[model samples]
Target: MPKKLIQRFSPKPETLKAHPHLKYFGEILQNPNLWHLNRRSAAGAVAIGLFCAWMPIPFQMLLASLLAMFFCVNLPLSVALVWISNPITMPPLFYGAYRLGASILNEPIREFHFELSFHWLAHAIETIAPALLLGSFILGVISAASGYFMLRILWRINIANKWQRRNKK
Candidate 1:
């Protein structure tokens, strides 16, 4: 059931090949494993996506895509998963990460209001950088590992069920 859901939603392999904007990827995108929706590919993509989603940077999808190609994961799924950190979800997730970082480093958490000025933003970032970075790393690792194992288990259960059904017939 999970496999079927993936296949139904995953883009056709040709989608990337035909994309004019993705030309920068050049031949790297040609790797067949990047397009396949198999257990390994899907699991790797999910992991990559989860990892990239926690990154507090621009172009998260691009990063996910590059890593997916390098790791031979499902390219579309890797890119799609980064959307889990979309605008609606960004604030709480990032706050959670910051809190986690503060807890881990045993640092006092500061409460500050948002200031749009460059000086204020830079100062805030400098003060919070350590916590934010550490929290993001920890969260990313945990989520990525969880996603990989969960997908693998789901795949195994799906395959076993298929085999049982086939044998019964």
Candidate 2:
């Protein structure tokens, strides 16, 4: 005897409309051009956003968002990318920046310490003064370019699979 076929069903439109955030999510999900965006453009935006986000610059999130919007990238994703150098990751990220600066300038790695004394602010500035500007920019650019290429390759593979599935259907 032959087996019966099973039919799968999608959620109804009314069910989707009930959730508030779903409306926005649905808009992105239904955009036909989402997959059509050029891989290079997507990659470039991701790279630039990630780079700007990871830099030790102040107001990095604002900068990344502005750049993302300026570049016509997915703003949410770019903003989310800012966590690349959050509190948890700051140690290694800043260390890498210091190392990069030291290697370039042939200088020894400077020791960093934080104290609550009245003069702590002045001391901190004196320690990090020289390397802050250049180190942050170099590392930001490197990380951003790396993130862009990595994300591009992954996205391409994912989009290709999706395209193949759509074609098959």
Candidate 3:
């Protein structure tokens, strides 16, 4: 079942609550619903996580966790999803967003040369910020909606199959 599967992969609530960074959220993290593995929480966490993953911000996991807390979703899963945009995958995913945004806004796609210097970073941000932000927002929304609905459908199907097996016995 999705609940069991998610629970198996999720961090324990006590561990999260004990974490120094997450402790800043205080008593809000104590809400039981935020840790539940129900369909609504799981799907909502997926949506929140996917949306935050597409964000260009520095603290996507923190953002995901905050959203999960606000929405009363499965906090661990939401936070975990932000790893989808970790260092290994970030370049391609962000570049794709930049390309899409440029296409949507009728901006010319520019080739990026990576430089370790702050000056190059600043210049590139000035040129690409608008397209990158727009594209990221679009992708985030699409992924979130897709994840929410897909999880709901898959969870329902899993339940139905289990019921069928039980009835056969």
Candidate 4:
């Protein structure tokens, strides 16, 4: 099986425990289920991470961790996937999400520059926030479901291929 995709980023439980931010989850973060690299856990981790990455808020990684803890997925994988919306990709990703939202809502897609200032935020909230929020939520659901199933299918194929090779041997 192509297990190394996960193992490349999957940190040891002790390594996570040593991280300062994870200290907030207390003993809950230490659960064995949260660290398991099995198919179910890994798929759920991708789903949870994808969903949380679409959130229009700060501390996305923290939120992903919290959701993974709640849903019993691989914690490190959940944290890593939120990098999908990292600063470098944020503008285009969010703009696409906003466009999707506007199209779904049948609202006019607003044209605005991507700016991080408070004035821009306030203006955006008044103008495109509704479409943006709706679009992001919908996109998140779609992304999470896609990631979950994609991982599951790939994992299944990998295992099947491995078994076939072993039988040939």
Which residue pairs collide, candidate 2? none
Candidate 3 accuracy as lDDT: 0.93
Superposition-based RMSD of candidate 4 using all C-alpha atoms, in angstroms: 1.7
lDDT digits (tens) for residues 1-169 of candidate 4: 3568668756779988888986887899779999888899989999999998888889999899889988988888899899889888888888888999899989997778868899998998988999889989999999999999999999899899989999999
TM-score of each: 0.95, 0.65, 0.94, 0.91
Tell me how far the alpha carbon of residue 95 in candidate 1 is from the true structure, in angstroms, after superposition: 0.3
Give candidate 4's error at residue 158 in angstroms: 0.8
Of 1 and 2, the candidate ahead on lDDT is: 1
Per-prediction tally of clashes: 0, 0, 0, 0
Alpha-carbon deviation at 31 in model 3, angstroms:
0.3
lDDT of 1 by residue, 1-169 (tens): 3777777887887886888898778888888888878888989999999999999999999899989988888999999999999999999999999999999999889897888899987998788878988999999999999999998998899899999999999
lDDT of each: 0.91, 0.63, 0.93, 0.88
TM-score of 1: 0.95
Residue 115 accuracy (lDDT) in model 3: 90
User: TM-score: which is higher, 1 or 4?
Assistant: 1
TM-score of 3: 0.94
Model 3: per-residue lDDT, tens digit, 1-169? Answer: 4577778878889998999987888999899999988889999999999999999999898899889989999898999999999999999999999999999999999988889999998998899999999999999999999999999999899999999999999
**Candidate 4: lDDT of 4?**
82
